[model samples]
Target: MRWRVAFPGICVLLLIAVILTSQGERHVSLSDGVVAYFKRQQPIFAEKTVQLRRHIEQLQPGDSTSLLAARQALRECRISYKSIAFFLEYFFASEAYVFNAPAKYEIEEPYIEYEEPVGLQQIEALLYDPQVWQHRPELAAQATVLVQTAQDLHALLYQFSATSAQVTESIQQELIRIMTLYITGYDAPLLKSGIAEAAAAMKAIDTMLTPYQDLDKKDSIKYYLQQGIHMLSTQPDFDSFDRLSFLVNNALPLQRLLLNSNHDLFSATALKKDVFPHKDITGDTALGRRLFFEKALSGNATRSCATCHQPERYFTDGLMRNRSLTGNEVLPRHTPGLLYAAYQYSQFWDGRVQSLEEQVKAVMHSPQEMNANDDTVLHRLHNMPNYRGISLLQVQASLAAYLRTLAPFNSLFDHYMAGNKQALTDEQREGGNIFMGKGQCATCHFAPLFNGLIPPRYNRTEFEVLGIPAVDDLTHPLPDMDSGRLAFFPIGFYKGTFKTPTVRNTAVTAPYMHNGAFRNMEQVIDFYNKGGGNGIGLSVPNQTLSAVPLQLTPKEKKALIAFMEALTDRDPIAH
Candidate 1:
């Protein structure tokens, strides 16, 4: 009896000690630690920028030795900047743009007045072109601009103060961004240092995440980080790196672990905002929901967002293509379901816009859609009895917010993946296996989200050249004349390429593909089973989809459809 009483007392003492120890560790402020890290990195980046500028200045026209030295210096500067890419991109997006943007500019309708390229990439482009050596003044001017930008970025770091949520979100976002952009060669298209750069990015993330170590499961996160670093380090080259394996084995697990750690450190309420830095809407407000369904924002009194994206019909109008504003002609593309739309990096069938708000603005002004400019829409909204004095920006923000709320991944398949095995039938399970393994669906569509955005990171959306037929009739199979992504990018490889849409709610969002040519899931599957348009005797030289026939049995095709149907989100939109 005495021994039992003594053991209980000892247990209480041990519990008390653990609590005190945790409290002591908590006092070390994660926010302060992150701020200090950036402070240290800021000066390093600045110094490198200065060094690169000096190298550019020292360059002698047509001298190969001078050119090589300058190129090496510029590469060093880029490497230093890449280490803090996550922090710079998250905190100072606009300033980050000044550091690196595409060199090319469009001169037509969507008229972006292209600024002179002025960063490491611009310098790299100049160094590679022997002819550009004659334009020494231009090179020096761009180098000066890069130095100033770096200095400005350093100064901004002084004002940086991270909340626990922001730090966690930023790290998570950067991981995805690295996977989507860095690994895919989107960021360093010219340099082709994707492998080395990805490793550097992972190392930087390791440094940034060091402060939150106490919040993580002991040794759990460290294991994944080390594994990721090791895997990336050992890779021979960018093309040979097993991206799928890395995402499945290392990155996805790490993301979940970090997310859980963040959840443990911060309240869910605090973390429930835009993951991006500057967005105004949180999508949790009643005002946003009201604005989403409001007709006053439209030119036609009866038409609103709900007119095309009906809530009862899984957010699609349930048409091959929705009728135009006048109801006389059909819109160019099928109305993509807004459910899970927020998860995508770009918006629209052609991916013409980046932000959700920007997409709203585009739709509102399109003559075939809302047919109302910002000014006219705002005027109508102000005159509404319930929405008096609403600004155009507010309308856009609210709509974006509401659209984001529609993206809840609570499907039966999600439940099955979360460990409730009974959530899926035997056929559905087989279908999933076929989808992931034999069908080669996961290679492009990815898992969980099952979209081209790619998982573990979800940083970029992919457009694919499928060589889709213009119509369902394959008798004389003509390639779709509607140059999909080529309309925007005007590149030969982008011909017939369309943004890969999410299959989350494919059971309902019918008449699939950008053109809504396929009437059912069977038709869509048949197109893929026979190896896309190329296998059907159409001359598609740049088809991204494999021309080799899948040879999936009819039963296998039915099972695939069953699995997709299971992906339908179970949760109802509260509004």
Candidate 2:
């Protein structure tokens, strides 16, 4: 009886002690830490913007000292922006666009809303102009706008609130952005401050991860961050950096670690709003497989989806451009491989449609393609025993479900990344090095997906003006007549722009480019090597691809092809 009484007294004492200890050392939640981090970064960014504005105001015609100071100040502002970029971009995307958007007018399609380009990139372009003094008024005006935007962001931070889950998601996305955008110098093309900015971003991530007590691989994460930051800081050169090695060694591992742990927490939420949410995907895929090959779905009851995207040829019809339903003339564009098409933010070479379902509707309704009306498609489905009860939307959902399953990451390169060292030959590895480094292919064709879908968020697909010629004549290249994305958007900036397709399965998929200008991979490499059509003296003013020659030797070109060949899936063709 005495021992039991003493035990109760001891429990009470321990509870009191626990309360005292908890009160003495307040536990900072991950949400609190993230909010704190943003708060801390806000003033720093604002100060940098102010300094940048001051430098811009002090500029004089042919004043090198003032010019140098302004440039340095701009670099500092960029570094500060990078530290908070992940959070700003993920949480406040519309507002953040004013911080570092591309220096080109962008139109939000479907909505057709116009957004004038502003931010750091605009200032950088003006500052780095050959005749900078001539653009002083524009420069000063942009700087003032930038300063105001920074102040706006500072005010916005007061209302910023992120859960632990959101913070973790932001960090994971930042890892992807670092790999796809930052290291490649996507935005900082002129300034070339990408490496330094990447380092700053990594350091911010290190700080952000501090409050997560459940992070089991914290040491490994810290090591990767340290190593990556060191690499970026020490070897700041853009062209010669061993980007492939960095990706394979540090960034990829770190990305996988965080993402794998957070997969269950955020996977469903990460999916695009355009995707049709399905419960029984396996059932849908099996049903859709039959409908995919049904000729009755076409208006003429002749060509099917499989007729153009045949399974034997990795979903391509082995044609530069497939014959139309009439079989009299060729289609407008090449039949893009359906293997990884579902992963992109949009469908078609021009990316007019946002979802696979929408793409299905467009293709079926098109006069040249399938040319099937809703009534015809419904009537066809009504006769089919399995699809009788399904609505047209249900049919589209089933097809999209099947499309999503095509991405099987079992390629030789995927295996190599998965720790099978012998999966890739040394020559292929060298090719990869060139592709990521001097070749600069990875800048447009990001890894894993190797498509135009911009990573971290994967919410946008990029369009590039490559200046692909009408015919394979490098000597006297004639620009393709295809207006590309400009046909729909009708913007000068979008003229000649086409979505960057996946380079995966390039070994088999021949007659590349939207217009099918290249007959083989060798021809494709030669075209890019000569610096696209612009380098070969085509009048391509809006060419996104650099006109400067890649200068790849013959041996390097072969290796590059080998690397691309390794992207072929190891398993049987999914289509």
Candidate 3:
């Protein structure tokens, strides 16, 4: 009787164990789920494209009603496109460029002949303008191109497939991109439709992650997503929106959580090699130190690399412009500090070179700079008994290696971002808020790096047309005469454009701007407050800086300066 009772109990326990085991073995594939979701979105996007084309076709000559309809249709199309933005940007990057690339093209991109702006942005620029009626045919042509691109995007969605890791990584990157670019009004710079588009993107993310709701930590992730969407939905005006709060509270924490949940899926993708790859020699070593300070690399041994890049003054020569090797003329531009130069994709004020090694070669070969050719440099090094076997290539590699080690990101601000609240004082923290919020510094400078390398990818550097004054006097202003990027690009809009340099050690590296026109940070702040050269009565048609005054108060201006000073890195190696 006892054996019979025990057998029944055993059977019940065994059945429960089998069910639990089966449940444990079962795994829902998120990759397949996401693929299905993308496929579903294809038809919706196609229909929206058709609607956009129809609206464009319905444009009657000088009819406000028809134009209004067209604008509405265009906004609807943007909304539809934004719904699948994360997937499109990740899987179809090249094709997506045709959908909404920047209006301007880089001069270095020789493969693209007659680089005219095409895509949604091109159409939007025309449609939104009051003068669009005058250029109806041009607007119509751009609309047709947008229609075809949207169709291509729809077709391409069917070919999309991603691993779970890829999906997770792409989502994480998209979140960061949304906060950094989309929220900052970069994507819809002319339209000011950033808030609406951001909402659409958030909705899309919610939809994409819905199928994976049963995963571990789903509740917490869902909470963050909902909170972010709520924050975006309730945003005030574009200018007054608390971007600092949004970034620190909503966006950043959400990104961290998402990344942590899929820690195993995250890995560094292969970065493009610098134009000239250096051997594994870091600057902290004795050999790298020797190469960096070596004067033999110069044709005239009167100066070394450290001559212009003095370690005592935060790697800057503390001059408006450095004297040339001949000591008769000055270099064209101000000497930019080498503190965080390694993080940039391109070097020099014009962004003509691709690597630090290439920059070294250019500087050495230039008559105004070091004035040493590769052969001459090698010969000089060969004559030195200690450097007898050193080649020109080795010199380049060693110097580049040393410069790469100068990327010190450990500022008090960096520590604050990493989680130490006490890293900033009340005044500094308030100033930081204004910098990101009212001042609009974060839009161009970006975060952490305070450079225009554009995060989440950081592959390409950016150039901006600030229209800095020819002289410091605002009352009698003239545009800086340097052709700047136009010297190399030869494009009309690129005239006076310069690469955005880092403000990392700006406190120490005074005499700001490419021309070193500003004597102090106060002057720089005042210039920006007055809305760059254009606002100060200088004729700069293509000035990228906003023409509207920042209207920063004396207190706020002081705070902004304080925040910049906080970015000063603790030197890893003092002279």
Encode model 3's per-residue lDDT on 415-459: one tens digit a residue. 666557788887777777677657767667765467766545554
**Candidate achieving the largest TM-score:** 2
lDDT, model 2, position 264: 17
lDDT of 2 by residue, 1-575 (tens): 00000000010000010101132123336667777788899888989999999999899988999999999999999999999998898788876788888766665655556666678987887888778999888888888887788777757767667655566666766777787778877677667687788889998998876443234554466677777888988988866676767777788666645654432111223333333322342338776777788787789889788898887888888888888889889898989988877766667888787678778768888889989888977887788787787777776767777777776666788777766778899899888877766676876786656776555545557788888999888888887999998997787767888888988888888989998888999989888888787888898887777666778899989999999999887663643
Show the colliding residue pairs in model 1. 176-457
- Output the worst ten-in-a-row residue range by lDDT, candidate 1: 1-10
TM-score of 1: 0.57
Candidate whose lDDT is highest: 2
Arranged by TM-score, best first: 2, 3, 1
Query: Which residue pairs show backbone clashes in model 2?
Result: none
lDDT of 1 by residue, 255-308 (tens): 657655322111212122244222554433466678767776667755788889
Q: How many backbone clashes does candidate 2 have?
A: 0
Write down the lDDT that model 3 would get.
0.68
TM-score of each prediction: 0.57, 0.81, 0.80
